[model samples]
Every structure is written in C-alpha cells, then in structure tokens.
Target: MLKVIFLAAFAVGTVLADGELIILNNPGSVHFEGSQATNQSFLKEVFTVVLGYTPKLTQPWDGVEIRDPFLLPEALVSIVIEGVESVKSPRGKHFPLNVDEVEEVTWQAVSRRLEERDTNNTLVRIRVGDGLDALGQSALGELKPNSVDPASLKHLSLNNEEDQKFIEELQLLRAIAQKIPSTVTANSKPDVYWFVVSGLRPVMDLHGKDSEATKEALKLLNDAVNDLSNAFTDIYNGQVVVALFTNDANKLRNTRSVESPRVRREEKAGELETFDAAAQNSSDNLNTIEKSIQKLATDTEGLVEQIVDALETTTQDSEKSTTESDLEERKDDIDSMHSSENDYDPGKPITLRLSKRYSANYPVIFNIFLWFGIVFFFSLLAICIAIAGMDPGRDSIIYRMTSNRMKKDN
Candidate 1:
C-alpha cells in the first residue's frame, strides 16, 4: 500500500524544460587621433549620421567605445584616420620626369633606371605620387619596362612626414583588408570594413593650395578610395559598407544611416504562463487525490469498527460468521485499491517544467515603420479636416451662415 502511494506521488510530480534564443549585435571600435578640433567635428558628424543622434564629445575617443559589450558581434570598422600626420622618410636625390614629354612610363622602366643608377639599391628610393602604393609595388616586381601604363611610372616625389605617415596608414589598411574572407556563405553575412579619411588639408597643402598639382593629387586620392571601396564590396558581396571622404566635417552629417548595425530577435519569449497554469492544475489534482485517500482511510476504519461491534454483540454462530465474512470482503476491497499493480504504474515519470522568459526591445525597422504609419495617418486626418473647414460647397452650418452673410453683403 505504501509502495503504491509512493509510486503515485512520484508519477504525479513533473519536470518541465525550456530553451531560449540569444541574439548578439556585432562589436565595433573606432580610433580617431588627430587635431582636437577636426577630430571632434568629424566624430560628431559621423555619429550623428550613423546613430541619428550626436554623441556628447567629452573624451577624445568617447564615441568610439561601444556602449553594450555583451556578445558583441565583431568590429564593423576597425580603423579610422582623421588629420593624422603622414610619416617622413629620409630625403635622397630626386629624379625628375617631365610630365608633358612622357605619355606613360612603366614599372619596368623605373626599376631598370633605379638598378642602373644605384645598383646597391641605396640612395635611390621611389614613392608613387598617386595612392597606388600596393599596385605600384606589385607592378615593380612583375611588370617589365615599356608597359606604357600611365599609372605605373611617375616621378617619385620627395617623401615628407605626412607622405610617410600616409604610406604606413595604407599599409595597415591593406593588411586588415587582406584578413577579410574573399567570399562568404549564403547563410552568413561578412563582417564590415569601414574606413573614413577626412581633413587632408596638410597633405593637400604639400602642393600649392590652389595649384593643378594639388587638384591632381586630390583626384588620385579619391580614385584610390573608390577602388578600395569597390574591392571590399566585391570581396564581401556587398555586406554593409561606408567609405567616403569630406573636406568639410559638417558635410559628413549629410550621409544617412551610418549608425551601427543591429541584431534582430529571432525568437519570442518562452511560454512560461502556459507552463505555470499546467503546474497549478497538477498541484490541485494532487491535493484532491490526497484528500480523497485520507477520507477513504477514515471511512474504512469506521467500517471495521462497526463489523467488530456486530461480531461482539451477536452470539449466534450464523450472525457472527456473516459479520466476519462482510468484514473480510471490505478489507479485501481496500487492499485491492491500495495495491501498486491496480492503482499506479511506476514505469512513467511525471515531468513539469517552467522556464524563464526573455524579451528584447522592438527592432529598429518595426519602430520606424510604426512611426511612419502613425505620421501618415495623422497627416491624412489633418488634410481632411482642413478641406472640410474650407470647402464652400459643404452644407455645414458654418458654411451656410457664411454664404448667407456673403449674399447679404453683395
């Protein structure tokens, strides 16, 4: 009997299990180092365009630090260059090429000249005036002279501090770009690569401020940035990308949606309310069964007492036998009810589980759509109100009174 009760209790107890989905937004870090004024201006403009709000510029790199770090996706833009001075290299003798005379010079021609003039590779250095640092080096190695490529051969300018810094910066950019996968699977999106170069006044000033040379240099720089942007787009299959330059920091704010990418919640919160209701129902059923069992036990005890009294009071043999028989039958029924085989099965364990629920704020897209819908509705309502008030053909009381007054004046 005891074993049967224990088995039933175990069967009634339940365990419930649940699962959750976690979403992580990618992590991004921006490093901006340069003139305080220029840096602050650029930072404000970029964050405003990206985040839709201008971040307070308390620290030099305040806005660069990511706000939420838990399971941060990955850095979208790893490097930012703002008004940093270019590196300086030792000055060697300059080799002049008349731009008007030579239509194009190839890498082979320049390399041959360098080899012949300075066999030791000492005192002869080359800096491609254009922003083709990587391409120039590769061409020098692989291309032969007489290729007649306009971009291949140009007069190497004397390296300045700013020029050297620019070269190193390009090197860093290339290295970082190389690490990005050339291709991504359809199911996955590639990480972002963002590079912003602003306020190149000093570099531009290296040439006369308004000179043709300065214009050419600026054009080359723009072309390089475009080339890099296209290359990354092709490699990443056009996952989010922002590569732009601006002379005016203020103009940077005009670019829209530069803000950080967001993570969308893919799953709804767990069904905890349903689980709680089920657990409560099971508890109530268990309590009811327990009370019934206690009542049955008390009733069985009373029946046994009545049978014993009948046996003691009746001296007749037949009456005593009948009472004893009735008592035995009642006891057997109670025993059958308490038997494990008849009352409870121990093979199945009851399980009831309640899980915690989690929820994320609404997605940005949903919020945008919701607000746009609301605004459109309100604007439509306003338009209808205005038309109703101004419509002269309408038979409203105000319009009718106005018409009568106008007729009277006429």
Candidate 2:
C-alpha cells in the first residue's frame, strides 16, 4: 500500500511515520535546535507505533545522533534545505508573493519535478513550520482572512503560522482528492498525501517584544490553530487518527521552576527502614539460637541413652538356643529350596520366554474395499460371459470390420 508522508516541525531532524502523523512541533517556542526535534522528544513514541519503526532522530548532516534513517530496513528519501526561514514578510512586497505563496508553489514544483521511477507513483509532499505563539482565531474577529486562495495566508503580513499551514494543507488535500479518479482504472496513480508543519517564527521576527504586536500575533495564531484543528477533524472523518501533543520544552523559553507538591514523599524516610529493623532483629536471632544449643545438647545425650537401652532390651529378648532337631527339620526345607530340579541354581544358564505372535486385523474400510473388488471382478466376468453369447449383425461395424467379404467387395 502507498503510504502518506508525515510533516513535523523539526528544528533539527525527526522520525515521523505514516501520513496520519501530523505533528505541529514548536509552535511559538525556540527554533533551530529544540526538544521537539530530539530522538527522545514527544514524537518518539508516536514514530515508534505509527511509523512501524523505532525513532532515532538526528541533526541533518550530523554523524552522531542519526538513528532510524540508517537502521530502518526500508529505503527512504531525506531532503533538507539549510538556512530557509519558514515565514518572513518582506518590506513592501519585495518581489511579488509572500512566504505562504512560495510554499504553495514549492508544493507544485515538488509534485511535478520528482520524476517517478514508477509512472503510477504519486508523490507525497510534507511542509513543516513553527506557529506564531499559536495562531490567529478568525472567529474572535482578531484577524481577518485576506482571501480563500493560497495567498490568504501570505497576505496576512500577520504570519499566523498555523493559518498559513492549514491553508497549505487544505490546498494539497484538495489537489490530492482531484488527482484521485472516481472509477479505478487498470493502472491507477497513487494519490498524494501532503503533510504540513507551520511555526510562528515569522511573528517573532516581524515584531519583537512589542506587547501590541504579540497580542495581535496571539489572535491570528489562535485562529490558525483552530483552522488546523478543523482541518485535522476533516481528515480524521475519513477514518484517520489525528493526534495533538504539546511539547514540554517548546512551550516557553524560560520560566521559574515551581516546587512540586510531591516533594514531601521524597523528604520523608522510606518504609524500607522498617525492613532494615526486621533484618537487624533477624541477625539478633543467631545469639538466641546459640543459647538454646546447650539445652539441645542435653536432650541429645538423653536420646542416645534411650537408644542404647532399647538395643540391650531387644538383645535380651532374642537370647535363645538352637536344638539339633530344629536343624534337622530345617535341613529338608533347605534342600527343597535349593533343589536342582527347579533349575534356579547359579550354574544354570538364563532363559528368555517368547510372547505369542499375531497379525493385525483389517480395518472396516479395507473390508469394504475388499468386498467392492470382489463385486467388481464378478460383474466384469458376467459382462464378459454375456458378450460372448451375443451374435453381431452383418450391418454392425464390428461385423463389417471382422468380415473378409467387405475387403473383397471394396
């Protein structure tokens, strides 16, 4: 089965599996190198179960931490573009289109340019970016959408990372839907699964430390997140599992650590102290056992005396004399027991007894087979006898073949 590519915002590199794994990594947090991109990050378990692989994330072109890409049994294509900003609004429209526009165009180019080794191969494109504090919530009237086209996200100068991302994802999903044919042909092209990850680095870059700007970005980013959520729901309606995870480290740059309420457990002495006391008491038991050993020794001496007395009593009870008559009476018994007629002497050779021999009876099925064979033989003999009594007609083919008159006539 053709599988979809996963899009996850990776400050470094990440192991994301299946088209269903859509990770919105590092929305408004740090970029370039962050926790979300690590091998042990939030997406690790996600990759392990869904991607049918153990996650081993690494920095692009770095030798040290790269795991899954090298260890995975299947072949995978890895693409990395260095020093590319996810979203940045230029001064007074530097060229023509904005970041979102370029991203959409890039999708088209990637789809068309990657010449498939198999003509039926459909390309799956993944786009990843960080969110701007989150995204602008359009419903709250915080930010207005410029247009429904791809430019809608780009023109926002307000780079709501998720808005731009959702717009892009929606566009790609539609494209893939269009590429799919209603009636499956003998040779059908694989539908493309476009993955998108959007981040709010643009909002940070555009307006730094401005409270008003930050507030504006929050509104826009909120909307974008909602849009992304709605998009996920739409995708999930087709029976796809959509999961959302907030990375612990990516939530903020710096914050004071709060004292954990569970600290009391750590401070208290462990229940192991009771076990230790019991162990000490067990060691003390050796001394008590040693004290009892003296008493046990006395009991042992008494037991030995009783055993000796029992032996002497039995010896006295068995004291008796054998008579010459008794010997003579036993002589006959002894002779009978060792009689040569019995063939039980040590000088005699050993003999082995033979068991009876018998053949196995035929099974019921075999008996039936035997009866069938007899009936068949008799039936054939009767048929032969009946044929032998028949006279063939002169017009019959058998008579014509056997007659010399036919040859002569011919």
Best by lDDT: 1
* Local distance difference test, each candidate: 0.39, 0.37
Candidate 1 residue 47 C-alpha distance from true site, Å:
7.3
The TM-score of candidate 1 is 0.26
Least accurate 10 contiguous residues by lDDT in model 2: 90-99
Error of 2 at 90 (Å): 34
Off by over 4 Å in 2: 1-237, 250-275, 281-298, 313-410
In model 2, what is the error at residue 84, expressed in angstroms? Answer: 26
Instruction: Return the top candidate by TM-score.
Output: 2
Q: Each candidate's root-mean-square deviation in Å? A: 25.3, 22.3
Give the lDDT of residue 195 in candidate 2. 41
Residue-level lDDT for 205 in candidate 1: 58
lDDT of 2 by residue, 241-279 (tens): 222322222222122123333455544545567778877
